[model samples]
Target chain A: MEVDRTDGRTPNQLRPLACSRRILHRAHGSASWSQGDTKVLVAVYGPKAGTKKNENPEKACIEVVWKPKTGQIGKPEREFEMILKRTLQSICVLTVNPNTTTSVIVQVVHDDGALLPCAINAACAALVDAGIPMKHLAVAIFCCLAESGYVILDPTKLEEQKMKAFVYLVFPNSILSVLPEVSSTMKGEPMEHGIITSVTHGAMSENDYFLCLERGRAASAKLSDFLRRSLQSKVPGDSSKAG
Target chain B: MLMEAKPSTSPATFVDKIVVPGDVVLDLSTFTNETIKLGGGLRQDRDAISVMKAGKLKFSKPNKYWVESSQRRYVPCMEETVLGIVVDCKADNFLVDIKGPAIAFLPVLAFEGGTRRNIPKFEVGALVYVRVVKANPGMNPELSCTDAYGKAGEFGLLKDGYMFETSTGLSRMLLSSPTCPLLEELGKQLSFEIAVGLNGRVWVNADSPSTVVVVSNAIMNSESLSGVQQKIMVEKLLQRIK
Candidate 1:
């Protein structure tokens, strides 16, 4: 299943992205995000103490609710929730908001495919909007190998069907922080290894696995840049020091 | 010591010296000198003395000057009538975005006096007439839809309507318009109070029965005025009715 990714973009190229904070008036923090045609609105509430007895008391509990258009909770929504919860928990400094729950609610008003990764990005933006303390912002990128052996980055719905496997690239801050520091000082060191998190190959060959990992790393790096820029504009001031 | 009397050219100068405790005198001889020498004070240049007068001059207390600018006051404040939306409702209050400088809190207790189904009766996106019971800086604005008139009485209440975005200054103009005859013709004019929050939230509500109609008409006709200008006109109009 060969897929011709739009714009002749390589498997490492990310889609155009836009993010806005305080998109809604009621929520503590709200953000609207769009990656290609996948648009999602995420609202973050709390750091307010949770009511349920099982709610965590030592660290902030993250609950993600994904709503798709015209249906109840489905498999795709659940999968995105799990992935987003895991990815976000790793980056967020939950201890800062102890005994409270930070809920990330993502409403997929429009789905043009590739919803999970979009939801993850939207949730990250919402968390930032809510002013949550995080060690680093988490960014997710999707990659897949086409039937023709070409890997695609940020696959659309139509392209997803033609792919054998999809990988979600999760990049932490070390990769970005190291790139600028190393490029200026070292002569031979590779500028790419800083990608701390990459989930690839639910099913794929060893060769394809490595290829997907490389693609994931490259794509995640690009998304990290995009997320930084997006968060910068919404926060009204330099948020780099937030970490 | 007697000082030369100065002619009043600028109102500010006359008022400024009036506040000082002294008998201000004017001398014609100082006019030719381009400078005046005072008995108990330093010699002042010609520009400092506006004019010269003769004889013993009597000084009086300076009148307080009230500087009025074109700016309208419409930010949301406590106990002021306001128009807002139910962006979100909590157990005790609703978050309202007033068209002024900040968000104001309208507690459920503020509405307790009015006839409404119950607390938290409003839903998201519902527009209602509310009063600003409290406002905190950099905090979520709370609003109360229930007032003496009840849940935005038929004419006074606005559930679904077009929200015209304009500056707080302009909204004041529309509300303060003195020349607007519609208010007087309607009779029993509405009493309204406005609070312009520092966060750019504007809250307006009318206490009189005719307030809704008059406000709507004034706002509708205010399309020609810009935001700040409209507020001025409205403020003037509202003042005349009161």
Candidate 2:
């Protein structure tokens, strides 16, 4: 059975995604990512001198500051910041810049739906723009589970309010490794199928949550391809005499 | 018998190609006898070498590989010449900001022919050309104003000039061999003294402040322009300056 979204999107169709890097001038790295009506602007600074107190000084630290479109930061914003920080920490090569603290400041331009996923995407792009060392790039996607047992890839604000549950899932980018026949799979699943972070809202059965994860993982591959293409297309000075 | 197994994937295929983090770039199983030096963005993961940043894979002959990318922030590396702004002057060292993760310490005695009695006085916020001596993790990098032989070889303070920041890639382009077209075109008409630091800082000086401004702006604008575009842009700027 096909699920019809309010925006006329099919169950598997995601909202259009747009990303631009190096958008902020003064920041070491910056990017703005938007999905449909939701947009997030991220500025990356530091690997600065030292980590914050309580943070282990032996390894690099990640600090995320979330600014909503309006109002002061509340419980939800704090949760978003924590989730974003941990998600970024996992993908980044923290040991490469030990004792340094990289700050990722996320400013919510708009939050129609899937706000956390958009912010995560923006932060990941900003980190890449800043040239921070990372083990891999991460792709975040939002999945909505309707009461009818159908899952939707990306939802709008109206759809989100009507959904029974929603989940934000982050996955490592599916890499096209140059190695000839080396398997990139773990057990029976591809490595990129492993979830880096998952945030759920409302109540859902274990089976429903796994369904959402499967749908979200499938959508993330497309997002990762777009990310890789955009990054490669705009390499600085590709045609210059620097080569 | 293992040496007879020729690897199908060669590192040469990815040279000058774009690679992102987690992309396996080199299969080390092929080169049993040869040793390869890995640079900034490439890391060894078991027998597979992978990239840790998004950039072009650059290979220099004999066996050196690295990832090159343009960015505002610089990760400090050893023996790199950089222009640093002194943030604070302590009794024995000066804290300098080289656009790196932390402030580097330029020892008071690291200068040429330096002695405890003749320590150079550098005011806070002074710009000096220095070389990174040590860049170990978990420690503030150390800087020296003198070269390896303890001589002040163009390593000192600038009397008067205009200093500007650029992407590290642009500064590298300015210092590339066969002098980039933009610099060549500017030099044909104008005379300017320029110092390029690997940490994305450039200093230019000319007889007139106007020339300094022109040279700096030209260099900054030429970062995204092609070689021919750079030549054309310089011509246009020189015309405007006149």
Predicted model with the maximum DockQ: 2
Model 1, span B1-242: residue lDDT tens: 13233333223343323111111223233246443233211112222321111011123343222211111123344555566666767666666655433445566556544434555466777666666555443344455555545554321336333344433323444355473343333333455543322222334455654665566567545533444655567667778767
Q: Which stretches of candidate 2 lie over 4 Å from their true place?
A: A235-243, B1-8
Q: What would the per-residue lDDT of candidate 2 be over residues A1-243, giving only the tens digit for each residue?
A: 977777888898888888888878899998888888898999999878888999989899999999888989999999999999999999998898899999999999998998999999889988988999999999999998888888998788988888888889999998757666545567768778989998888899999998888788888889988888767865432211100
What is candidate 2's TM-score against the reference? 0.95
Task: Give the TM-score of each candidate.
Answer: 0.48, 0.95
lDDT of 1 at B75: 30
Per-residue CA lDDT of model 2 for B207-235, tens digit only, reads 99989989998998887788899999999
Please write out the lDDT profile of model 1 over residues A1-243, one tens digit for every residue: 433466576556566777776667567567777777778898887555442477566667788878777778878668778878788777676654455567788899788756777777777767755555565556677778777777777777787887877777666522221012333222564433444345654467778877877777766666666665554342322223211
- For all predictions, the C-alpha RMSD in Å is 19.9, 3.5
